[model samples]
Target: MPTETEREESWLTRDELEDVRGRVPMLYVIAVPVRVGEAGDLDQVGLLLRASDTGRMERELVAGRVLYHERIRDALVRHLEKDLGPMALPRIPVSPQPLTVAEFFPTPGVTPYHDPRQHAVALVFAVPVHGDCAPQQDALELAWLTPSEAASTDVEAEMAGGHAVLLRQVLAHLGQTL
Candidate 1:
Protein backbone atom coordinates (compact mmCIF):
# COMPACT_ATOMS: atom_id res chain seq x y z
CA MET A 1 0.00 0.00 0.00
CA PRO A 2 1.16 3.53 -0.75
CA THR A 3 1.44 6.11 1.96
CA GLU A 4 -0.71 9.24 1.77
CA THR A 5 2.36 11.26 0.87
CA GLU A 6 3.29 8.87 -1.90
CA ARG A 7 -0.29 8.92 -3.25
CA GLU A 8 -0.25 12.71 -3.28
CA GLU A 9 3.07 12.71 -5.06
CA SER A 10 1.67 10.46 -7.78
CA TRP A 11 -0.81 13.13 -8.83
CA LEU A 12 0.46 15.76 -11.21
CA THR A 13 0.54 19.41 -10.30
CA ARG A 14 -1.59 21.81 -12.33
CA ASP A 15 1.38 22.98 -14.34
CA GLU A 16 2.73 19.48 -14.80
CA LEU A 17 -0.66 18.20 -15.93
CA GLU A 18 -0.93 21.01 -18.43
CA ASP A 19 2.52 20.29 -19.81
CA VAL A 20 1.78 16.59 -20.01
CA ARG A 21 -1.55 17.21 -21.73
CA GLY A 22 0.20 19.20 -24.40
CA ARG A 23 2.69 16.43 -25.01
CA VAL A 24 0.37 13.39 -24.90
CA PRO A 25 -3.20 12.33 -24.60
CA MET A 26 -4.22 11.67 -21.02
CA LEU A 27 -5.77 8.28 -20.21
CA TYR A 28 -9.11 8.32 -18.39
CA VAL A 29 -11.65 5.86 -17.03
CA ILE A 30 -15.32 6.64 -17.48
CA ALA A 31 -17.80 4.51 -15.58
CA VAL A 32 -21.50 4.67 -16.32
CA PRO A 33 -23.34 3.41 -13.30
CA VAL A 34 -26.54 1.56 -14.08
CA ARG A 35 -29.37 -0.24 -12.36
CA VAL A 36 -30.23 -3.66 -13.69
CA GLY A 37 -33.50 -5.49 -13.19
CA GLU A 38 -33.97 -8.93 -11.71
CA ALA A 39 -33.42 -10.55 -15.09
CA GLY A 40 -30.28 -8.54 -15.65
CA ASP A 41 -31.94 -6.10 -18.01
CA LEU A 42 -30.87 -2.50 -18.07
CA ASP A 43 -33.20 -0.46 -15.87
CA GLN A 44 -31.88 3.06 -15.59
CA VAL A 45 -28.83 5.19 -16.26
CA GLY A 46 -27.24 7.45 -13.65
CA LEU A 47 -26.15 10.96 -14.43
CA LEU A 48 -24.72 13.72 -12.30
CA LEU A 49 -25.56 17.40 -12.54
CA ARG A 50 -22.51 19.39 -11.64
CA ALA A 51 -20.90 22.73 -12.18
CA SER A 52 -18.22 22.65 -14.81
CA ASP A 53 -14.93 24.53 -14.76
CA THR A 54 -16.66 27.38 -16.61
CA GLY A 55 -19.28 27.56 -13.85
CA ARG A 56 -22.01 26.22 -16.10
CA MET A 57 -24.06 23.38 -14.76
CA GLU A 58 -24.05 20.26 -16.97
CA ARG A 59 -24.89 16.60 -16.75
CA GLU A 60 -21.98 14.18 -16.70
CA LEU A 61 -20.99 10.59 -16.05
CA VAL A 62 -18.75 9.09 -13.40
CA ALA A 63 -15.32 9.85 -14.82
CA GLY A 64 -11.80 10.70 -13.76
CA ARG A 65 -8.18 10.42 -14.84
CA VAL A 66 -6.18 7.27 -14.10
CA LEU A 67 -3.55 8.21 -11.57
CA TYR A 68 0.02 7.02 -12.05
CA HIS A 69 0.58 3.47 -10.75
CA GLU A 70 -3.15 3.05 -10.19
CA ARG A 71 -5.18 0.25 -11.73
CA ILE A 72 -8.03 1.28 -14.03
CA ARG A 73 -10.54 -0.46 -11.75
CA ASP A 74 -9.18 1.50 -8.81
CA ALA A 75 -9.65 4.74 -10.70
CA LEU A 76 -13.19 3.76 -11.57
CA VAL A 77 -13.99 2.99 -7.97
CA ARG A 78 -12.40 6.18 -6.77
CA HIS A 79 -14.29 8.33 -9.22
CA LEU A 80 -17.60 6.58 -8.61
CA GLU A 81 -17.24 7.14 -4.89
CA LYS A 82 -16.11 10.69 -5.44
CA ASP A 83 -19.29 11.62 -7.26
CA LEU A 84 -21.82 9.06 -6.05
CA GLY A 85 -21.00 8.96 -2.37
CA PRO A 86 -19.47 6.02 -0.48
CA MET A 87 -22.62 3.93 -0.39
CA ALA A 88 -22.66 3.36 -4.12
CA LEU A 89 -21.44 -0.22 -4.25
CA PRO A 90 -20.24 -0.59 -7.81
CA ARG A 91 -19.72 -4.08 -9.20
CA ILE A 92 -16.73 -3.80 -11.44
CA PRO A 93 -16.38 -6.45 -14.10
CA VAL A 94 -13.44 -8.85 -14.01
CA SER A 95 -12.50 -8.02 -17.56
CA PRO A 96 -11.24 -4.53 -18.29
CA GLN A 97 -12.64 -4.55 -21.80
CA PRO A 98 -14.62 -1.38 -22.18
CA LEU A 99 -17.95 -1.29 -23.95
CA THR A 100 -16.30 1.29 -26.14
CA VAL A 101 -13.30 3.57 -26.33
CA ALA A 102 -14.05 7.24 -26.68
CA GLU A 103 -11.37 9.56 -28.00
CA PHE A 104 -11.99 13.14 -27.04
CA PHE A 105 -10.03 15.74 -28.98
CA PRO A 106 -9.35 19.31 -28.00
CA THR A 107 -10.80 20.41 -31.30
CA PRO A 108 -14.44 19.90 -32.15
CA GLY A 109 -15.56 17.60 -35.01
CA VAL A 110 -12.42 15.53 -34.69
CA THR A 111 -14.47 12.81 -33.01
CA PRO A 112 -17.83 12.17 -31.43
CA TYR A 113 -16.33 13.36 -28.17
CA HIS A 114 -14.72 16.72 -27.50
CA ASP A 115 -12.70 17.93 -24.56
CA PRO A 116 -11.39 21.43 -24.98
CA ARG A 117 -8.86 21.09 -22.19
CA GLN A 118 -6.92 18.10 -23.48
CA HIS A 119 -6.95 15.08 -25.71
CA ALA A 120 -8.40 12.32 -23.56
CA VAL A 121 -8.66 8.63 -24.38
CA ALA A 122 -11.34 7.13 -22.21
CA LEU A 123 -12.16 3.50 -21.48
CA VAL A 124 -15.88 3.41 -20.93
CA PHE A 125 -17.76 0.83 -18.85
CA ALA A 126 -21.29 0.28 -17.65
CA VAL A 127 -21.05 -0.63 -14.01
CA PRO A 128 -24.07 -1.92 -12.13
CA VAL A 129 -24.35 -0.20 -8.76
CA HIS A 130 -26.28 -1.89 -5.94
CA GLY A 131 -26.35 0.51 -3.06
CA ASP A 132 -27.68 3.86 -1.99
CA CYS A 133 -26.40 6.79 -4.04
CA ALA A 134 -26.19 10.35 -2.86
CA PRO A 135 -24.60 13.04 -4.92
CA GLN A 136 -21.22 14.14 -3.61
CA GLN A 137 -18.32 16.41 -4.44
CA ASP A 138 -19.45 19.05 -6.93
CA ALA A 139 -22.52 17.10 -7.96
CA LEU A 140 -25.70 19.04 -7.41
CA GLU A 141 -28.03 16.08 -7.95
CA LEU A 142 -28.28 12.59 -9.32
CA ALA A 143 -30.75 11.68 -12.04
CA TRP A 144 -31.72 8.18 -13.08
CA LEU A 145 -33.32 7.89 -16.45
CA THR A 146 -34.52 4.99 -18.51
CA PRO A 147 -32.54 4.01 -21.54
CA SER A 148 -34.99 5.67 -23.92
CA GLU A 149 -35.09 8.86 -21.93
CA ALA A 150 -31.35 8.94 -21.65
CA ALA A 151 -31.09 8.70 -25.42
CA SER A 152 -33.42 11.63 -25.97
CA THR A 153 -32.08 14.76 -27.59
CA ASP A 154 -33.16 16.97 -24.72
CA VAL A 155 -31.10 15.03 -22.24
CA GLU A 156 -28.18 14.88 -24.61
CA ALA A 157 -28.34 18.63 -25.09
CA GLU A 158 -28.10 19.12 -21.35
CA MET A 159 -24.87 17.13 -21.12
CA ALA A 160 -21.43 18.57 -21.75
CA GLY A 161 -17.92 17.32 -22.52
CA GLY A 162 -19.35 14.64 -24.79
CA HIS A 163 -20.78 12.68 -21.89
CA ALA A 164 -24.09 12.38 -23.69
CA VAL A 165 -22.39 10.64 -26.58
CA LEU A 166 -20.79 8.24 -24.15
CA LEU A 167 -24.13 7.54 -22.52
CA ARG A 168 -25.65 6.70 -25.87
CA GLN A 169 -22.85 4.30 -26.54
CA VAL A 170 -23.52 2.60 -23.24
CA LEU A 171 -27.19 2.26 -24.13
CA ALA A 172 -26.27 0.70 -27.44
CA HIS A 173 -23.96 -1.70 -25.70
CA LEU A 174 -26.89 -2.87 -23.62
CA GLY A 175 -28.95 -3.52 -26.74
CA GLN A 176 -31.09 -0.50 -26.08
CA THR A 177 -30.83 1.70 -29.13
CA LEU A 178 -32.35 5.15 -29.32
Candidate 2:
Protein backbone atom coordinates (compact mmCIF):
# COMPACT_ATOMS: atom_id res chain seq x y z
CA MET A 1 0.00 0.00 0.00
CA PRO A 2 1.28 3.47 -0.84
CA THR A 3 1.34 6.33 1.61
CA GLU A 4 -0.16 9.69 0.66
CA THR A 5 3.27 11.05 -0.22
CA GLU A 6 4.05 7.96 -2.21
CA ARG A 7 0.77 8.21 -4.05
CA GLU A 8 1.48 11.85 -4.87
CA GLU A 9 4.95 10.98 -6.06
CA SER A 10 3.62 8.24 -8.30
CA TRP A 11 1.09 10.55 -9.93
CA LEU A 12 3.45 12.28 -12.36
CA THR A 13 7.06 13.12 -12.96
CA ARG A 14 8.29 16.38 -14.48
CA ASP A 15 8.20 14.98 -18.00
CA GLU A 16 4.79 13.45 -17.40
CA LEU A 17 3.48 16.75 -16.02
CA GLU A 18 4.68 18.56 -19.13
CA ASP A 19 3.03 15.92 -21.30
CA VAL A 20 -0.23 16.31 -19.41
CA ARG A 21 -0.04 20.08 -19.65
CA GLY A 22 0.34 19.79 -23.39
CA ARG A 23 -2.59 17.42 -23.75
CA VAL A 24 -5.14 19.02 -21.42
CA PRO A 25 -6.03 22.19 -19.58
CA MET A 26 -4.77 22.18 -16.01
CA LEU A 27 -7.08 22.99 -13.09
CA TYR A 28 -6.12 25.89 -10.83
CA VAL A 29 -7.60 27.84 -7.94
CA ILE A 30 -6.86 31.51 -7.31
CA ALA A 31 -7.58 33.29 -4.04
CA VAL A 32 -7.86 37.03 -3.59
CA PRO A 33 -7.80 37.49 0.15
CA VAL A 34 -9.20 40.65 1.67
CA ARG A 35 -9.76 42.22 5.05
CA VAL A 36 -13.20 43.43 5.98
CA GLY A 37 -14.01 46.30 8.26
CA GLU A 38 -16.56 46.35 11.09
CA ALA A 39 -19.28 47.47 8.68
CA GLY A 40 -18.51 44.48 6.43
CA ASP A 41 -16.94 46.73 3.86
CA LEU A 42 -13.66 45.69 2.31
CA ASP A 43 -10.60 47.11 4.03
CA GLN A 44 -7.43 45.91 2.41
CA VAL A 45 -6.51 43.68 -0.48
CA GLY A 46 -3.58 41.28 -0.26
CA LEU A 47 -1.14 40.61 -3.08
CA LEU A 48 2.04 38.64 -3.23
CA LEU A 49 5.20 39.97 -4.85
CA ARG A 50 7.13 37.15 -6.39
CA ALA A 51 9.90 36.57 -8.87
CA SER A 52 8.70 35.52 -12.26
CA ASP A 53 10.36 33.13 -14.72
CA THR A 54 12.21 36.07 -16.22
CA GLY A 55 13.57 36.92 -12.76
CA ARG A 56 11.52 40.09 -12.64
CA MET A 57 9.39 40.97 -9.64
CA GLU A 58 5.66 40.69 -10.26
CA ARG A 59 2.49 40.85 -8.24
CA GLU A 60 0.18 37.84 -8.06
CA LEU A 61 -2.70 36.27 -6.22
CA VAL A 62 -2.63 33.14 -4.11
CA ALA A 63 -2.69 30.42 -6.75
CA GLY A 64 -1.84 26.76 -7.17
CA ARG A 65 -2.76 23.67 -9.16
CA VAL A 66 -5.42 21.30 -7.88
CA LEU A 67 -4.06 17.80 -7.54
CA TYR A 68 -5.88 14.84 -9.07
CA HIS A 69 -8.92 13.68 -7.09
CA GLU A 70 -8.43 16.46 -4.55
CA ARG A 71 -11.42 18.49 -3.42
CA ILE A 72 -11.49 22.17 -4.37
CA ARG A 73 -11.93 23.31 -0.79
CA ASP A 74 -8.92 21.30 0.33
CA ALA A 75 -6.87 22.67 -2.54
CA LEU A 76 -7.86 26.20 -1.57
CA VAL A 77 -6.88 25.61 2.04
CA ARG A 78 -3.60 24.03 1.05
CA HIS A 79 -2.66 26.85 -1.29
CA LEU A 80 -3.75 29.55 1.15
CA GLU A 81 -1.61 28.08 3.86
CA LYS A 82 1.24 27.42 1.47
CA ASP A 83 1.47 31.06 0.42
CA LEU A 84 0.01 32.91 3.40
CA GLY A 85 1.56 30.86 6.22
CA PRO A 86 -0.30 28.80 8.82
CA MET A 87 -1.08 31.72 11.11
CA ALA A 88 -2.73 33.65 8.29
CA LEU A 89 -6.10 32.02 9.13
CA PRO A 90 -7.97 32.26 5.87
CA ARG A 91 -11.76 32.23 6.08
CA ILE A 92 -12.88 29.69 3.55
CA PRO A 93 -16.24 30.46 2.02
CA VAL A 94 -19.30 28.39 2.94
CA SER A 95 -20.27 28.00 -0.70
CA PRO A 96 -18.00 26.25 -3.18
CA GLN A 97 -19.03 28.62 -5.96
CA PRO A 98 -16.29 30.90 -7.25
CA LEU A 99 -16.49 34.66 -7.68
CA THR A 100 -15.22 34.37 -11.24
CA VAL A 101 -13.37 32.18 -13.70
CA ALA A 102 -10.06 33.03 -15.38
CA GLU A 103 -9.06 31.04 -18.40
CA PHE A 104 -5.35 31.24 -19.18
CA PHE A 105 -4.34 30.37 -22.72
CA PRO A 106 -0.83 29.62 -23.87
CA THR A 107 -1.13 32.28 -26.53
CA PRO A 108 -1.20 35.90 -25.51
CA GLY A 109 -4.27 38.02 -26.45
CA VAL A 110 -6.51 34.96 -26.50
CA THR A 111 -7.98 36.15 -23.22
CA PRO A 112 -7.39 38.53 -20.34
CA TYR A 113 -5.22 35.81 -18.81
CA HIS A 114 -2.16 34.18 -20.34
CA ASP A 115 0.17 31.46 -19.16
CA PRO A 116 3.12 30.71 -21.36
CA ARG A 117 3.83 27.46 -19.57
CA GLN A 118 0.42 25.83 -19.98
CA HIS A 119 -3.28 26.32 -20.52
CA ALA A 120 -5.02 26.65 -17.17
CA VAL A 121 -8.57 27.20 -16.02
CA ALA A 122 -8.75 28.88 -12.63
CA LEU A 123 -11.76 29.29 -10.39
CA VAL A 124 -11.22 32.54 -8.53
CA PHE A 125 -12.56 33.46 -5.10
CA ALA A 126 -12.62 36.59 -2.97
CA VAL A 127 -11.68 35.22 0.42
CA PRO A 128 -11.94 37.20 3.64
CA VAL A 129 -8.94 36.55 5.82
CA HIS A 130 -8.44 37.31 9.51
CA GLY A 131 -5.18 37.11 11.43
CA ASP A 132 -1.77 38.23 10.20
CA CYS A 133 -0.44 37.12 6.83
CA ALA A 134 3.20 36.35 6.11
CA PRO A 135 4.64 35.50 2.74
CA GLN A 136 5.86 31.95 2.38
CA GLN A 137 7.64 29.76 -0.16
CA ASP A 138 9.21 31.68 -3.04
CA ALA A 139 7.18 34.84 -2.46
CA LEU A 140 9.31 37.89 -1.76
CA GLU A 141 6.70 39.74 0.25
CA LEU A 142 3.01 40.34 0.72
CA ALA A 143 1.54 43.79 0.09
CA TRP A 144 -1.69 44.95 1.70
CA LEU A 145 -3.18 47.73 -0.37
CA THR A 146 -6.30 49.80 -0.29
CA PRO A 147 -8.79 49.29 -3.12
CA SER A 148 -7.57 52.45 -4.80
CA GLU A 149 -3.93 51.53 -4.40
CA ALA A 150 -4.56 48.07 -5.78
CA ALA A 151 -6.26 49.56 -8.80
CA SER A 152 -3.68 52.26 -9.28
CA THR A 153 -1.88 52.47 -12.60
CA ASP A 154 1.52 51.90 -10.97
CA VAL A 155 0.33 48.76 -9.27
CA GLU A 156 -1.44 47.48 -12.35
CA ALA A 157 1.67 48.06 -14.41
CA GLU A 158 3.73 46.02 -11.94
CA MET A 159 1.59 42.92 -12.24
CA ALA A 160 2.40 40.27 -14.80
CA GLY A 161 0.61 37.29 -16.38
CA GLY A 162 -2.71 39.17 -16.42
CA HIS A 163 -3.01 39.21 -12.66
CA ALA A 164 -3.90 42.89 -12.94
CA VAL A 165 -7.03 42.02 -14.87
CA LEU A 166 -7.90 39.36 -12.34
CA LEU A 167 -7.36 41.83 -9.53
CA ARG A 168 -9.64 44.33 -11.15
CA GLN A 169 -12.27 41.66 -11.60
CA VAL A 170 -11.95 40.68 -7.96
CA LEU A 171 -12.32 44.28 -6.85
CA ALA A 172 -15.37 44.71 -9.04
CA HIS A 173 -16.89 41.53 -7.66
CA LEU A 174 -16.34 42.87 -4.15
CA GLY A 175 -18.27 46.03 -5.04
CA GLN A 176 -15.19 48.19 -5.05
CA THR A 177 -14.53 50.50 -7.96
CA LEU A 178 -11.14 51.56 -9.28
Among the numbered candidates, top TM-score falls to: 2
- Model 1, 1-178: lDDT tens per residue? 7876765445678999999998899999999999999999999999998888989888899899998888888899999999999999999966567889999999999987999889999999999999999999889999999999888998888898788888888998898967
Q: What TM-score would every model get versus the actual structure?
A: 0.92, 0.93
- Candidate 2: residue pairs that collide: none
- Regions of model 2 farther than 4 Å from truth: 1-11
TM-score for candidate 2, please give it: 0.93
Clashes of 2: 0
Cα deviation in Å at residue 172, candidate 1?
A: 0.8
Residues 51-163, candidate 2, lDDT per residue (tens digit)? 88889888999999999888898889899899999988888865678989999999999998999989999999988889888999999999999999999999998898899
Residue 106 of model 1 has an lDDT of: 96
Backbone clashes in model 1, listed as residue pairs: none
Error of 2 at 46 (Å): 0.4
